[model samples]
Target: YRTKIVARSQNNKMHTIISWSIPLGNNILLSYIFAYGLGNHINITSILLPTIGILFIALGNYMPKTQRNRLVGIRIPTALNNDINWFKTQRIGGLMFVVGGFMMIGGGFLGMISEFWTIALMILPLVLITVVPIIYSIRSSHKA
Candidate 1:
């Protein structure tokens, strides 16, 4: 399914880049998971949380390079309107992703406590990472 999305991509370069991102991201995520031999005695939540985190880090790293485009990055209209907003949003997003990745690694440790807390640690950081940038872009645009 993901391959089809990448193969059928339209003229938008960012769209194409972001489209290919998923499969490439997944490869990285899987590589990290297996690199640890977690598969030998896998705790499902422990493995899953870190996998998502690694991918978030990769995507966030890529965000700043996306430029303003309908098909990628934070596509909110106000953000797309200015390069400052776009880059600022991406920078913050990248930082959040890196932080979120660490949080997920910590969450993997928490998996021994309970799956709920493990999932929460991973997901909350990601949610905050995504939402804060959007809000920042919108508010900054209003100020301008």
Candidate 2:
């Protein structure tokens, strides 16, 4: 992929620059940085960094809202087994992500959690929430 910029002045002067490389999608890099608690101190940056990263990750993973048996979306085997279940699972997962992200962001301001625990606090609920739908979908599928 390549990006280019061109600018022209009233004096008829022009400047052009072109860059070529795979775009480092912000989510990919931010997730790594947030995973490491890069800006995680008892400060604004601490809360903002991870919150932004999580939001990007959530948005990027669940865009276009199509039902699919893919790895990134709601991939409950049962959900993938049917289109309606897939849609419902994805919607629920997306809502869970939003709630989880907000919770983590709110938790960041509390200052009671140590940096280490903050990372865990932010991640664990999301994992649990993500898992619930899969488990439910499986059970529901099996029952059917």
lDDT of 2 by residue, 15-92 (tens): 111011113334445665776686543454455545554663455345326435343456656787886676767666
For candidate 2, report its TM-score: 0.54
Query: Scored by Cα lDDT, where does model 2 land?
Result: 0.54
Best by lDDT: 1
lDDT string, candidate 1, 50-129, tens digits:
76777667777767766655656777777878988888887777788778877887798888898787878977897888
Question: Which residue pairs collide, candidate 2?
Answer: none
Task: Return the TM-score for each candidate structure.
Answer: 0.69, 0.54
RMSD list, candidates in order:
6.2, 12.0
Candidate 2 minimal-lDDT segment of 10 residues: 13-22
lDDT for model 1 comes to 0.73
